[model samples]
Target chain A: MLTKRIIPCLDIKNGRTVKGVNFVDLRDAGDPVELAAIYAAEGADELVFLDITATVEKRKTLIELVKRVAAEINIPFTVGGGISSIADVSALLNAGADKISINSSAVMRPELVSELAGEFGSQCVVVAIDSRFVEGEHIVHVSGGRIATERRTLLWAKEVEERGAGEILLTSMDHDGTKAGFANELTAKVSGSVSIPVIASGGAGNQEHFLDSFTIGLADAALAASIFHFKEVSIPDLKNYLKGYNIPVRIEK
Target chain B: MSVVIVDYNAGNVQSVTYALERLGVSPVLSADPEVIRSADRVIFPGVGEASTAMRFLKERKLDEVIKDLKQPVFGVCLGLQLMCAHSEENNTDCLGIFDVQVKKFEPTLKVPQMGWNNLEHTTGPLFKGIEADSYVYYVHSYYAETSEYTIATTDYVNTFSAALNKDNFYALQAHPEKSGKVGERILQNFLDIK
Candidate 1:
């Protein structure tokens, strides 16, 4: 059976982990490679490294960091943030990234999604959509959800899938840091509308939130940042908890 | 032992190379016929479209080289699909190393079944120390049907060949490089194949 995925997303700035990760075993918490290895050992289904780095010159740092992580970590990881062009994606994949996720770039030039899916195959192209429930409808937001776009959340999701994106990473801006719950209504609607797998992101405070995301949200995967980083929920315990609910999760032996 | 990962336009060969490095073997990513032919073990790893990959392999004449390899040759993901006789992906004909056909997954589930799934009914040297229900990472829309060559199987939309073994050629529908410790053991088993 295809197990529902449990992903731990790490924010990267200047090649170092932006949020302070509280791992007792980690000597250097800022090292993304070590944190990634630790997560893989603890049974993370996959890892996502969102490069929050600002400058283009320092982007090389992320590439080097990707290489180190790929060499050390055994599981698949996706590299995102500030990736707009084919060259940027080429460099990251060459540096050993299994997949690459695009956001604002795809919204700016939607053809980049098709181009990437054509060049690298859709299996490696993940389109991340940040949306927020505004007024009466869910609106698409870009530039790390700071700016709103003209596109509706559901239409954009369909468009990216039509453009050959293999997966969709849907993050609810309204629920991101709230710790209340996932945007289950939006997630369920998008997941139902698209044939590609949908990964529900944001608003995970406890193990029950993840369960809600998979069950109510209809997400194929659930991604959380602060919870996994702060050790609020160990992956094994989370998987075990999910298993008790009959959610098919991969438990590492 | 010399290990070579057949290189063409396939995506993400670096991960497979790194996995071998973790197993203490420096693998050469080469499209050269002589280099691949001379290697003690040849890993045919691939990611991307079937027809495009087939085009690149034919242009470089690696297809014939791969078809004739006598050493223990392992194929991963798209590599496994391309080894089959035909692929429903792009309606392309593959190097007929394995007697199976690749078909697209039905839309009842996600097109590209991406995530970890455990291997069942696994038997053969490649699964030596690996436990039953050991999960491996997979990301592909097409899968090769289970056949006489299937050594292991996994259930997704339906039962499909998780791993296939026929003579010196072995293939896995999953990415062993990205499958963590269970994947490490599978790669190590391939290395230990004398």
Candidate 2:
């Protein structure tokens, strides 16, 4: 009977919140701390802060930002991007993040997922997969969707779950920034294949898309950026809409 | 006054500290018996294998110290599991504060019942203004069956105790620290209790 979560992902660059189209043309959303507090108050089930510049900068702003956001909001927040080592995961957790998300690093070194999960528990480690449709198959994308690996989405997700990843954040690069709807087919494939919680991301335009992602995608949570950042769809409005559709949601007091 | 959180290789201590700080309560992380006993309240949070964690606790004599504490104590996730008489996890004996055994979830349902779950049957001051059937986040495979100490119940594949209370000892299977406002309100209720 766990409530279906409504999450808003904030892509951070240079300590500022930014959202872009297809991971480019970045625009300033606002201060991460401010935006995180707003989302928490507005009934967001959780928050995801991805330091988009972590690899290029060779440093992570997520830990400090997580510390600041954790000081303000009383909800679960996940920090991801440029998490390459156990030290990085430890730092983010110490900074107050409830979960640490790893993308390219985890893909490159699959053992890192199990190692961290073994040390910190699987519940704290989230394996984020950026997948793109290629030649009629979902191929795993790395380096922030710049490079496509030979592995298929379902194959890698299964491996990560076997290696002890507690949750999977599946974002479809083709659907990202499209504002159409989630990759329901791909999500359902992964959700049906893995027992871990699957958070569906990318291509969420309206409330119907959210509903589709849950009912059809079979996702435990639906995560979006543009719709939430631009105020095209508020968390409460979305939650009310989902409730009307028989999806269990936690209404704000 | 700062609450002391015992860090004996358990999980979620940092999140608990973070949640307390967000509530305007500063909490200090410590494993020293003196620090824990001196604090206004003590929080015991854990994750990972129960037997291994119990080994860490027993080695530090924390098991004895934690049992002898007079201040209010709160256990989260595996911390709650370890406070029981025994756990199916690694077949380890626990602190016996709750006199119950923690059993693994039925294999029929998915292992590690992750994500947000609703607390259906609830009571005690910890629930306070929180409505029955409120949702809280959970991630675990083992669960404590209903017992005399159970204060809240949640349903997944089946109904199980989500929260337990006995005297000054309180434990929650779900991560209240990560459960958002309902969780924050529960934390505030615990802080307000005499």
Model number with the top lDDT: 1
Best by DockQ: 1
lDDT for B55 (candidate 1): 95
lDDT of 2 by residue, A1-253 (tens): 7778999998888777774423222243467787777788788888998887745454555566777887778788898888889988888887888898999998899999999988888888999999999999999999989999999999999999999999999999999989899999999999999888899999999999999999999998999987887788989999999999999888855
For every candidate structure, what is the RMSD over all alpha carbons to the true structure, in angstroms? 0.9, 3.0
Deviation in Å, model 1, residue B158 alpha carbon: 1.4
**Candidate 1 displacement at residue A46 in angstroms:** 0.6
lDDT of 1: 0.94
State every prediction's TM-score relative to the real structure: 0.99, 0.94
For candidate 1, write residues A1-253 as lDDT tens digits: 8999999999999999996688888899889998998899999999999999889999999999999999999999999999999999999999999899999999999999999998888988999999988889899999989999999999999999999999999999999999998999999999999999999998999999999999999999999999999999899999999999999999976
**Share of native C-alpha contacts between chains A and B (below 8 angstroms) recovered by candidate 1:** 0.96
Give candidate 2's iRMS in Å, 1 decimal: 1.9
Model 2 residue A51 distance off true place after TM-score fit, in angstroms: 0.7
Model 2 chain A: ten consecutive residues of lowest lDDT: A20-29
